[model samples]
Target: MEHFALAKEFPPASEADWRAIVDKALKGAPFRVLENQLYEGFATSPLYTGAATSPARHGQRGWLIVQPVAGASLADAERQLADDLANGATALSLDLNNGPAIRKAAELKAVAGAGVPVFLAPGSSPADAALLLAKADKTIVGTAGFDPLTVFAMSGEVPADRKAALADTVDAALAIRERFPLVTPFLASSRAWNGAGGSAVDELALTLAAAVAYWRALEAAGLSREDASRAIGFKLCASADLFLTIASFRAIRLLWARAHEAAGIASNEHILLYAKMPPRILSAYDPQVNMLRATASVFGAAIGGATAIEVYPFDEAATEPTPLSRRIARNTGLVLQSEAWLSAVADPAAGSAYVETLTEKLAASAWALFREVEAKGGLLKALESGFVAERLRQTAEKRERAIAHRKERITGVSVFPNLNEKIALEEPAAIIMEEAHPTVDFALPAPGAGERFAALISAAARGVPLAELHSASRIVCDIIAGGALDVARRDAEPFEVLRQRADFALASIGSRPPVFLALLGSPSDYRARSLWVQSFFAAGGIEAVLPEEGFTDVEKLAAAFKQSPAPIACLCSSNSAYGELKGAAAALKRAGASHVYLAGPASLLASLDPNDQTAVDRLIYEGCNALAVLEEAQRILRVEELAEAAGLEAEDENFGAFDEA
Candidate 1:
């Protein structure tokens, strides 16, 4: 009887109510419910499924959640490392750049400890990784920038002939065999290709090309095949495309092992794969979406059989990852590993028909690309001819065009749009870096054109990397060799212009008092506050347009909505008018006004009230609170664009105009 009674009294559903129901389904406990259902858990792929591989070797224990800590100042960077460690971050990855950089591993070493694994990115010299390793207790798990492809990639200064001389730059890429044997050379990173605009297939091919270039260079430099095999490493980007990412990584091991075997240096050992989310795809709008994206990326990496993963904060592209964002990003992996027990199952995707089919396709396509790179004289040669970079540019253009057309939408970003997004990106805590926070830093001085002497002092005193000034062209350089046909061009995209125009107009989500007049008792109440309030709100640009009969609830008010739509409908009547109005007021405003409130004697109205005021989801009394909320909703609902989409005006003569806030 109680349940039945409550059902009759229950309030109508609100947006919040719907959200609660959906959220329960999204993160439902027990993962799989017999009554409800199960969203498949994240899974990975393995190379050998049916065939025998020596007993499952205790493949590397836990891998690092390495977050690159290279920042501006030594003090700031040190603080950054401490903060990263405090969060679930397991290690540090340094980014070494030439031209005014600190390279003070010894000085920064004071901040890191024996517990954290410190590694350097591939572009850094082995000496830098060695320096970091010397300071930290863990072995540096990094690669050398010594392959011919690397030389060609960084060939801004080196001559074509002499570029080969930098071969010993990172000890021919094989020095890891003697000292840091577990170090990765190019066994799993394809960032160079992926970041530039290369497709998933292109990434694998280019990495293979780079690997071949490394093998040739290392062999020429007098290294054994085994050493060369142990020296290379690979870095790849994980994305929301889970199947693609898993297929990509699983294919890397299979293909790389095949490449090594073909080169007469096959090893049963698995290649180290460090997967990170691509910064290029990260967006500043609806920054919270970054968290969801990163979570998906982590899932992809875990199931893709990545040896390690670096889940950068969603804000990585927009700004530095804050302690809170970093903690969340890091724990994302920890949660998957511990509570989710993802690591318990290896190559969970191995047997799936789709994954196996995708993996084989990727491998075949990558091998084809690898052969093409060789035909073009290898990765470095492709770089010299701008082949690879040009190819990447074209792909980047295609992606941009897709976004413009809305064929591929980035929610809360390029789509599901919100303009004038005020994103807050906290600067990394001072750990001992080179420069202050971007929000605090002043104007960038003229590149190379600025005073050289003064620049040296500012850079030295501040930790400004000089390369930042010289690389301005990289920004405008159409990564696509040929200018891509701008898919986002004006004629090509109409919504782009519309979206931009509406964006030029701002929204006032702020609160304001409603326009209302005091209701006079009895008949004077007929010319009551409701009449004045409706006029005042409309005149003041509030959405609510109450009518004389707007006071009634449901069944009656349905007729009012049939007349013309208004943002809200206020009820105006005297205490004695209650019996004639109360139930009607509740019925009319039902499923109608964005908000509704009342005026007059509360006690008198209560006596005549036949239906629950709470039924329609709200009951505003004669006060500022209800009025303020109503005004705010009117501003947000924004129903004034009555005929634009219908094109009562333009009809293809011209595009419509955006609403002015």
Candidate 2:
């Protein structure tokens, strides 16, 4: 058998050759149009000719399939744990925030004795670390989830005795390490930053800064540099942007290696990176699309060499996760690894020019920002000084503007919405409770942070109820309004609000707010815009009444508009046809249309008569603020006020009208 070299048969193509072809296609458009400017302050080109040099490698073969388990009771958690491990999951993340109370060591014997690594997310309480350490299986391994910095960032509060609380957290982490040698006691996570709408660069810098703070604190408490490094693990969010997500995971590893070098560690020791799917891109409408988003996120994380990955259920945004949703989420990783063989190679994106370049850019930008945070005294100081919050605010505002203008399209929510799809969510099961355990008051007077942690652990060993222990050990921190970051915002929230308003109107008024599409000229002239207009209105839950065919006569169009229930009308046609319908807008206004819109560019206004142009309220075209236009149409139809008058609480009040950009 002869293997032929294909490259020799084809003539070599240079960057110049590609440029010439692209230039011809672009015509007179600037070459810059082919470049994409990211919010990270860098630009990516359309082509790369060669592979990057010396890319970072994860030095591993496969990622752990981590499934999140949350339940209303211990039995529920146990059932989910067994089901997940039996099906496909190799690891478990126990969400203690909403899980059943564990009062005794035997209660968690099932979880710890399951023989798989367990990640304990103890929520905002540092005392929960003591609970886990008391009851955990001695061989249990993974993160203990003692992250004070992230908790502070999310809740905007610090202990009244901040210094003591910090010291106590370090002490608890050290104790955990002594007991469960393989378990990382402290977690340096980017959840707060990522959830608050920070960019990838922001997440990296903030997480690095927090890790650095923890490393120093652990060292101060008498751990060696290497031991301190080993005691901490990282958790980062993997978004749907494949290339960027891959770069982000790779970049964090590089950044951490640099940190190790700075600390005089001889070798770049392994770091545990736990990647999670972010909720920012999930949509409440057409939720099945979330499965696709989750697949992309899991693929990116695996390719970029994550140690573990967790995929959120597809219906998580709309309602509670059903058994089917959980099964699908778990299998998403299983199929990718087992069938796709994505984990068969290490550093799969190593030589790709685009990914490598992006990785470098992200690392450099994040390092610079990390240094900025360090110069401000640290992550905490930056937060207190409002530097971090302000930066996040700017990025969030920019993102919201892009989303409103349709520059950042959210499929199924802001575009291509299906209003008629019936979503039948399964009702959550009623939680069955066991007999209550008698509460024990294990109060200690004026103990130091270390002593308090020890007492909590001892109490847990004695089978004191978790609720009682939590109440006894609760730490009240001062609330800092100026330093608090906003809550996690979903990209589809604004449009979902409009849909809710329309639903309210339909229930109260026997119809959805309608928009009359007064298409001009023949079907060939207005067909495209008519469909576009209908879909656009459907996104905002408005029913667009499109004509079967276009009308060249203004009088006929106005008569149709008057006969319809729509209070708003939009003229849809070709630019030349729009020019031909000189009195269309004026006629619609005269026919009792409260507002009239033109479906072409504002440049067409020059061709219309002065009276016709003056009668037009707005222009509906690509790149316009669709949210604002929809809200205006809703206002013209009085959707909100009418619902209110019918004794319905208008949900749109929570989301104010989007400012037109």
Candidate 3:
């Protein structure tokens, strides 16, 4: 075989060469334009020249495809579970909060028989854990899902008897370990923080803090450091940001290892990382785009070395998951694994300078935040003092502002929206109620039962209902100062509200709130701004009535606007055209335009209306507060009021000096 060195044929490109090329492409723009500053307090460089000498690896070949099943009844759950298992899901997550009420030992055993691992999401109650273990197959490896700290953070309440509840959880975990060694009893999850719009740093810090709290609790209960570490697993949300998600997962592993090392534990055990797709990024407008998001999330999770991955159904935001949606969600992981071979390598992102650097930065930031949480006396105390809530709020507000200004564009919501998109959603499955049965009288466990798990499991085997089981371990804590971490919000929620208002107006009247594009000169002169203005308004569900042809005369454009039903008008044209037709805004205002908007920046306003500042009521340009502008337009057009007073004209009150034109 002939040997050829490609490196010798092509000289190594220096950083100067790259900068020269980039500078040419950027024209006069600064090189910093290519860099991006993340919410985690780090900037991403445009290029990386050095290679990482050593990088962490996932140390595993593939991840478990965990399918989360939530149904109205046990039968429904069984059906979905069977279908998911058959279609390549390697594990199952029972959404106890919304899924079937698995009360009896028989029900738990039946659902657990899929021959794959079962992760109890949000964790099972102490009593529920007992019931799960009473009939669960010992060979099945999974988690008991007893995560009280996360539950407290999410609900903004601590158990009135916090110590007893936590002690009971520890006892339940110990029992699960004795019966099923492969099953992890505790879960440290950051879904609450992630769902609350926390940054990757927030999620990592919170998870580490919560896990430390659990480790201390477990250790105090006579478990060794290694035992406590082994008994718990981690669950983190994998978002659409691919590189960030990868770095986040990798960073957590490093942090966990560091935490164990600090505790003087020399265990080489890998952390069980379960990466779940977050609902915060899911959009109901264009639900199909969620599939792409899910794919990206799965890729990130797999590359970053998740032990298990769960892909949320695309239409879950709009309605319950239909069978088709469930299959698509399940297949998303299967295709990536089987065809894309995403999981063929351990820590696929390892050795990439960008990923390694990001991982190190994220780990450092998260560790610092974790220490801050510790200074507040741990995750629970931080939540109690509203420290966690405040931090999450700050990040959430920053992210919201970015989305509102269109700085962070959301497809189909803030960017290219489809106003006329008839979303094809399958009708939600009808809830099947279980037939009422005679209530069974079962003696409740004492307030401080010695072995709560044993007592609960014995009671469960006697057919006691889940309600009675939960009543014995119910958490009744005080709500934090602010309500539960601001309810999970999507990036598209604000714009979606605007669309909803538009939909209501359309149903009440015959059309959506309209904005007329008062185009000037030839199509080439105004086409760019015309289209930009149209898409901008359409994002808010406001219909843009574009002129059939650009007009050179201001009177003709104003006459066309007067015939249209739009109460608001935006002048769209090139700077030269705006300078040529300086009377367009005045003419449109005289023709009954309630408000006039210029499509370009404030600089173009002087060309359109040099004498009167109010001639152009507002300017719509890139980086402007788009949501605020659309909302102001809605208020001016009275879209909400139009719903009640359909066909009634809103009197123009802001005609200004142009009224005499």
* Poorest lDDT segment (10 consecutive residues) of candidate 2: 652-661
Alpha-carbon lDDT of model 2: 0.80
> What digit string (tens of lDDT, one per residue) describes model 3 on residues 1-661?
2787767878788889888999999999988988998888878998875666665556866889988867767788888888888889999887554567665777876566778888888656776666666676678688888888887777777777756547778878777777788888888888888888889999999998988888888888878888988888999999999999999988888899889889998845477889999889999888889999999999888888888999889888777878999999999988999998887777778789889889999999999999999998888888888899999889888998999999999998899999897553344555433344334455544433236677887887777766667766554667766757765678888998888777766665556788888888988999888878889999888988877898888889888988777788988888788888767888888888889998887786555465435677888999999999999998887766765665543344322111222
Q: How much is 312 displaced in model 1, in angstroms?
A: 1.5
Higher-TM-score candidate among 1 and 2? 2
lDDT of 1 by residue, 369-454 (tens): 78888899776556656677666666666655554434455665434444335444344444433433233233433222113222
Cα RMSD, each candidate: 16.2, 4.4, 4.0
The per-model lDDT (C-alpha) reads 0.52, 0.80, 0.81
In model 1, how large is the Cα lDDT of residue 72?
58
Ranking by TM-score: 2, 3, 1
Cα distance off (Å), candidate 3, residue 413: 0.9
lDDT score, residue 483, model 3? 59
Return the TM-score for candidate 3, rounded to 2 decimals: 0.92
